[model samples]
Target chain A: MLFYDCSTAPNPRRARMFIAEKGVEVESRDISIAKGEQLQPAFRAVNSRATIPVLVTDEGTVLTENLGIAAYLEARFPEPPLMGRSADEKGLVLMWNAIAEQQGGAPVADALRNGHPAFKDRAIPGPANHAQIPELAQRGVARVAQFFDLLEERLNESPFIACDHFTLADISTFVFVDFARVIKMRVPEGNTATRAWYEAIKARPSAQI
Target chain B: MLFYDCSTAPNPRRARMFIAEKGVEVESRDISIAKGEQLQPAFRAVNSRATIPVLVTDEGTVLTENLGIAAYLEARFPEPPLMGRSADEKGLVLMWNAIAEQQGGAPVADALRNGHPAFKDRAIPGPANHAQIPELAQRGVARVAQFFDLLEERLNESPFIACDHFTLADISTFVFVDFARVIKMRVPEGNTATRAWYEAIKARPSAQI
Candidate 1:
């Protein structure tokens, strides 16, 4: 498989970390968002959406989204079982992962795209040129704080976000929590449970990658 | 299960439609965003994020994300297999679902939350208060258009967004496409393949609910 990645982006980083977690290796190509290479014709041919973290299987099938890539890798390498094993476990994994994406990942993107001057005319992810909105960043900061609170509440109840094991939900949530630092949001100093869980997950070899 | 829903919101509608598609009967309570009921402390107790479309399971588990509710429902009622049966199939379902969430749903939300005057001082989800950004709406419009193009390109190659059969990806995509109407954006006029697929999916009994 050939994986098109962007080192700076959170979404692609999720995929990269997942692949590393599964102990799988693929030919990696950098799609530099900093230089706007994703908008180039050569890259557009790979994905019309002009996004990164695309995985092209040896069969010539293109998987263009992070969840897709993660799912594929999880299924192919089931030893670690990042998604989950049983029916209920799978459901929990999916649930937590979605929450992380919507509550955590989305807000980070909103803040970055709307606040960062580097993305001035590229608020959206595709090839199109769309201007930024600085106000969204302020809102994003508030939403992210809430996200941290939500995670704290969840972590207080379960050792892991989904099942009792470390799943893709953990990966997504970890990335989101770490990414929150960029927006000047931290896991609240008072969120003891969340901080402990975050430290534990961070120590995982997969997280280091 | 009891579902907290809002008829007008796209995310809640996706969960409602997924339950409908699964042929499961859920006790649903409408949390009116227009009325600001989602901000009530009563609702916040159920979901700290204060987002709509939360599912309270028989086990008293409160699932707060659309994908979370869908996952739980699909697992509980597996006869229809909304995710998929095989590994590759599962990967495709997850891939397309993420694409729909990121490309279709996220942009629509960016447009609505940032553009709508109604969401002023409530730009982000959760109990916190934040203001809106009108400029994000313009970027949202452009991003949503690009999303349509991406969907059209995918639909042109396959009957469903994922594989040959209907799955959660289709459910999510259908809700997103239908919800885009709120922003006055419909599927592009000339995309015959997408239109046909949309009609067929729309005809499903689940879509009406």
Candidate 2:
């Protein structure tokens, strides 16, 4: 398998971390988003969407989305299952992961895309030209704070977002919480439970990759 | 099961349509977002994040995400097989559903939250106050276009987004495409395959409700 990767982006990072967690070895090829290489014709052939973190399977089938890559890997490497072992566990993993994506990661991304001067004409993803909106950044910052509070509350109830065991929920949430630093949002100082959980997940060997 | 729903929102509408598709009888309680009822202290007890489309199982476990609700319903009512039957089929359903969530549905939401004035101070989904960013709306519009093209391309290759069968991928994608109208974006006239697929899915009895 050939993994098309981007070091700076959060979504690609999630795939990379998941692969590491599964101890799966695949050839990695860096796709430089900072250099606008994703728009180049050569890269577009691999993925017309020109997004990073694409996995080309041994059969030459390109898995273009993060969840696609994760699902494929999870099914192949069922040990230390990141999705969940049972029906209910799978549902919980999907639930918490979606929450982390919608409530945490997305808000931070909106703030960056609309507020960052680097993305002045590229507020959205894909091969389109769009202007930025600075006001959304302010809103994103506020939303992120609430997301932190929500995470803290969830952590207070369970060791992991879904339950005592660390699953894909932990993977998604950990990436979002870490990515939140870009928007200048931190885990609240009073959120001891979340802080401890974050630290514990951070210490995982898979997290380092 | 009791469904905490909102009539006007796209996310909740996805759940409603899914339940309709399943032909399941669910008692739905409206949580009016326009009235700020979701943020009330009373509503927070049902869901701390205070978002709609929450499902309370007969066991009283609160399922807060769309995928969560879908998984619970699919398990209990397995005849229709909204997820999939085989391992490969399951992977495809999950992959397409996640793509619809991230690539299709999320951008429209970012556009709405950052662009809509009604969401002023409530740009985020939680109980906190945040402002809107007008620039994100432009980005969102562009992303929606790209999403359409992506969908068009995918539909051209297969009968559905994931596999040959109509699964949750179609359900989520159908909702996202329908919801895109709020952003003044519609299915492009040139996307014949996607248009045909959309019409077929729209004709389903579940889509009417």
Measured against the true chain A, the candidates' chain A TM-scores are 0.96, 0.97
Show pairs that collide, candidate 2: A132-B135, A133-B135, A135-B133, A136-B133, B121-B130
lDDT of 2 by residue, A1-209 (tens): 89999989888989999999888999999988889888899999998877777888776667776777877777677877887765566667778988888778877887888888778877666666667667666666767787888888788888899866988889889998999888777898899999999999999998887
All candidates: TM-score: 0.90, 0.90
The candidate that wins on TM-score is 1
Model 1 chain A weakest lDDT span, ten residues long: A83-92
Mind sharing the TM-score for model 1? Answer: 0.90
For each candidate, the alpha-carbon lDDT, in order, equals: 0.83, 0.82
After superposition, candidate 1 runs with Cα above 4 Å error? none
Worst 10 residues of 1 chain B by lDDT: B123-132
**Which candidate has the highest DockQ of all?**
1
